[model samples]
Target: MRSSTLRRHLGLKHEFQYRQWCKANDFTSMIPKDVKIRKNAAEAAAASQTIIDDHAVPLPRKERVIPYSDELFQQAAIEWLIETDQPISALEHPRFREMIGIAACATNGVKIPNCKATRQSIIALFKKNLYDLWTQFAVSNFCCYMVLSAY
Candidate 1:
């Protein structure tokens, strides 16, 4: 079960027992002495860092300029779907679309390619990869043949 669900169950079903257990167990005392020492050290370091940061001059915020290209985005989305073994229909999912939109930094969200376009893009990418592999194999074989001929 999810942590939230488990917490809710414990709170609703065993509130009394949980309170008794909390009262009985000194949680901090249960921790090893070394761990408690390290925890205190970390807290002290964080406090010093906070003080230093407060005294430091603030830097000017620069505006980030992200170039948006629909074709590139679609290609990337297609590749991501293929790499993750997700169905083409995943593009149409509301949550997925929202995430994509947020990532692309678009207020209304970017338009995702339809299933047909996505399928075509996947096929094209596969053919391109196959061609690239074939070319590499051919080049390697040619190099080997040339070396053999020279010898």
Candidate 2:
């Protein structure tokens, strides 16, 4: 097969695997349809005993172990600041760094950018959604308080 064809195949395989991983982790998204021929060929190759293990189809070479998505960062920020009810100012706290670490762990040990730029980016993202998230946190807390008081 031409190198271009192989590269395309590798991309497809990675896409399929990534979809599977996300689904297995209960992340909701529409999984793209796998290319039927590629799927079948891969299955057949796995089933067949090739003559040499060394020449076997190589595992996909992922450029990054953890695929960084904007949504992931947003979700993590929501989880940290809203779900856990941390103050917006707490973004400067070490707890925020721990939350970022948790996000990295959730992606199966993907390398998280821990530099100044990454911190700035996350801070910006959190700032962008601050008002809405704060409203949500207040409402949730009030509801919980009302429920407890009634009991």
Which residue pairs overlap in candidate 2's backbone? none
lDDT of 2: 0.72
How far residue 77's Cα lies from its native spot in candidate 2, in Å, is 1.1
* Candidate 2 TM-score, true structure as reference: 0.22
Ten-residue stretch with the least lDDT total in model 1: 26-35
lDDT of 1 by residue, 15-134 (tens): 667657757884432223434677999999987764565678877965565466889878888999999999999999999988866766665445668999999999999999999999
TM-score against truth, every candidate:
0.33, 0.22
lDDT tens per residue, model 2, 1-151 = 4765654664666767766776799864332344556677789998895678668788887665546788986776668688778788787789767876676656455555768989899889998799789999999999999999999
Model 1 earns a TM-score of 0.33
lDDT of prediction 1 = 0.76
- For all candidates, the clash counts are 0, 0
Model 1 Cα shift for residue 14 (angstroms): 84
Tell me, by lDDT, which candidate is best.
1
